[model samples]
Structure formats: structure tokens, C-alpha cells
Target: MKENLKRLFEYRELLFNLTRKEVKVKYKNSFLGFIWSLVTPLMMLVVFYVAFGVIFKLRAMDMKYYAFYLMAGILPWNFLSQTLTQGVASVVMNSDLVKKVYFPREVLPLSYLGSASFHFLLQEAMLIVFLLAFRVPLTPWIFMLPVLMLLEAVFIAGLTLLLSTLNVFFRDVQHFTEILLMAWFWMTPIVYPISQIRDNLPAWAAKLYMLNPMTHIVLMWQRITYNSPVNGPASYSMSPAGVIGTVACSLGLLIVGYVTFTRLEGRFAEFI
Candidate 1:
């Protein structure tokens, strides 16, 4: 395990090239180019806002009950969701290269994540712009963003490792992933705020939501942005304990995914 980790560091160039390739391919032959990333999320936000915010008039008590609420949650969710969907096909997409060359198989998945997250970063910048446009106050607590982002990277990479490897064997994994992702989006506290659910809700019910993990990530985001000037009193900011848990969970999933991938990778070339 230590050797594999060391090897990853040793071949950092390979990582860079692969990440660059993914990013280039992402915008390849596109008319609007990278604008697609920004457009997609923004368009979705408008649709959702009109449906849930206007028609239904959901009173999002904690999250300002507005478009910004969905923006914060959706931007991160879009990154995580899109990366996994596209990354599941990473190994197969490079099937020719995989057969001919020998590189850290894990690096392939990591590259997809790195490239996708680049777009995610752009979306985040736009999110910041929205916050500013609305006069949301900024605070030192916003510095916590990088830490949360790293946590997000860790979690997404882990999931990709597991999904991409399995995807090679079972083409149906792609279909299954689609269904799972749809369910996951709903499970996450993206479309709505967690606080609106009432503090006195049954413990089991809360557990059901928390089990999603993205729940914690979303709440942390709301806390960070809301603390500024957007939606004050939206949350209790992540404490040391919360930070530890986020990192631990991210690392734990990453390790598990690596083990599963290495174990299953031997079969990828054959089964795939």
C-alpha cells in the first residue's frame, strides 16, 4: 500500500498529462466550449427555481427560500454527480491505451476527477459572483472552502475508483449508476434545506438523510456561505470534529476504493 502511494507521487507527470487530456477532450469540438459547464448548471437552477420556488412556493425557511440556495447545493452536486457518471466510463473510454500501456490504473480515475473538478471550480467562481451580486457578506470562515473542496475531491475519487473498475466488467454498471445517481440527488439535501425539516424530527428519520454523506457536505456549504451575508443563522459551522470526520470519511472511502480497484483491476483487462 505504501509502495503504491509512493508510486503515485513518483509518476505525477502522468497524472498531469491525463488530467490535461481529460480537460481538453471535455471542450473538444464544442461550439460554446467550456461555457457548457456554466450554462448547464445555471439553466437547471432556473428550471428548479421556477418549479419549486415559484409554482410550489416552497418556503425554504433556513436557506433564504431562493435561487441561491439551489445554486450552492447544485454546483457541488453537479461536480460530484457529473464526475462519477463520466468517470465510470474512464477505463473503457481509454481501452485502447489501457491495453497498450502500463500506468497506475488508479491514476486514470483520478485524472477524470481532476479535470472535471476544474470545471467545478469555474462553477464555484460563478457561485461566488452570485453571492456578491446579492450582497452576501464574506468572512474568514469562507477560507474553509479549500478544506471542504479537498474533502469533496477525496470522496468523488474514491467512488470513481470503485465504479470505474466495476464498470469495465459490467457494462450494465452504467445503467445502474444512472438510477443510483438520480436516487442519490434526492437523498442529498440539494433541492431543499435540511433545517426546514424541523429540529424535533424522529432520530431515525434524520439518520436516513445523514446516511447520504452528501448531506453533511451540503450543510457545511450552507453554513459557510450562509454565515457570510446570504442566509445568516443557516447553520452551525463545521467544527474540528466535523472536519476530522469529513477527512476521515473521504480517506476511508478512498482507501477502500483503491483496494477494491487493485483487486478487481487484474480482471479488468480480461473481463472488459
Candidate 2:
């Protein structure tokens, strides 16, 4: 791992260039340019707020500003989904670079992550603006956001490495990833609360549902935004044991994903 880190550092310039390229190409030839990053999330937030808040009244019924509440969760979900969608194809998409250049293939996904992260932060700025506009009080729990975001990034990075490497051999992995993410987006409480699952699902099934690391991650985000701002006591539906289990699960996936990537990467050039 030390050697790999050292090599990546040696190629840091390439990493930056790739990340810049990814960010630029994303908005290139578009009239709106980077503004779309903020607009996309805002558009979705409006649609969701209208659909769930106005039409169905499905959000935290107690909260007055459902748009802000929905934006908070949606921004993070956008980051994760974007990272995975691009990361899954990072290797195959950049096959020319992989073949011509001699750098760590892992950097492709990392660079994509860097670009997505840039966009994530931009979207978050809009979320903060919404908070201020809605007069949502900022609480000390907002400090915990960095921790949750870090864990979520680590989780995505591991998956990126694992999926990018696998897609090189089995091209179907890329297509399958889209379906998986679609299902995952709904599975995670992006638009709705986790309580709905507990109320509707059997005890065993609810327990299984909470087993998803994203469940805790999303709940933590909702807790920080919804509960903390109102000075409502911090609460997570997942037990302490469940939280620990999810953290352990994320760490394990990181380790296993890295190991798997390194093992499979030897043949990436041949397959690509």
C-alpha cells in the first residue's frame, strides 16, 4: 500500500490533469456550464418537494421546509450515484490512456471521484443557500457532516476500485451497475424516511434493511439536518450495534475491494 501510494504521488500531476479534464468535459459545449451542477440538484429538489411534499405529504411531516430537507439528502445521493456510475466505466472509458500511458489505473476512478466531489461541494453550496433562505438554523451537528462524508467517500472509492477493475473483463458489469444503482437509490432513504420501512416491513426485514451502510449514512445525514437544526435531540433509528456493524462492513469492503482490484489489475491491459 505504501508503494502504491508513493507511485500515485509520483504521478500526481497526471491525476490533476485527468480530474480537470473530467470536470471540464462534463460541462463543455454547454451554455449553462458549471451552473448546471447547481441547477440539476435544484430541479430535482423542486420536483421531489412538489411530488412528495405537496402531492403526497410524504416527508418529515413536522418540518415546514421540505425542499431544504429533501435537498440535503439528494445532494449526497447525487454524489454517490455519480461517482459509481462514472467509476464503473472509468477503466473501459479511458482504455486509450490505459493502453498508451503507464500510470496507476486506479487513478482513473480517483480522478472521476475528484470531479464528482467538486460537483458535490457545488451542489452543497446551493443546499446551504436554501437553508439560509428557509431560515433553517445551523446546529453544532453540522460539524459531524465531514465525518459522514468521509465515510461515504471511502465507501464509494472502494466500490469504484472493485467495479472499474471488474468491468474491464466483463463489460456487462457496467450495465448491471446502472440497474444496481437505480435499485440502490430507492433502497436508500433519499426521498423518504427510513421509519417508513420499519413501519411497513417485518422486524427481520427491517433489520436487514438497516444492514445497508447507506441506511446509517443517510439517516445520519437526515439526523444532522432535520433533528439538529431544530435542536431536536440527535437520534438514529439504527441501534449502536447496527452502526458499528455498518462501519465494520464499510471498512471490510474497502479492504476487500482494494485487494481484489490489485489482484485483477494485472490483466486489465490485456482485457481492455
Q: Residue 176 in candidate 1 has what lDDT?
A: 93
Which sections of candidate 2 miss by over 4 Å? Answer: 228-233, 237-239
Question: In TM-score terms, which candidate is top?
Answer: 2
User: What tens digits encode model 1's per-residue C-alpha lDDT throughout 5-83?
Assistant: 8888888999999899888887799999889989999999999989888788764443363787788788888878888
Model 1 earns a TM-score of: 0.90
Which portions of model 1 miss their true places by more than 4 Å?
59-65, 199-201, 227-243
**Using alpha carbons, what is the TM-score of model 2?**
0.92
Q: List TM-scores for all candidates, in order.
A: 0.90, 0.92
lDDT of 2 at 102: 76
Residue 78 lDDT, candidate 1, scale 0-100: 84
Scored by lDDT, model 2 comes in at 0.79
lDDT of each: 0.78, 0.79
Q: Summing lDDT over every window of 10 consecutive residues in candidate 1, give the lowest-scoring window.
A: 228-237
How much is the lDDT of residue 79 in candidate 2?
A: 87
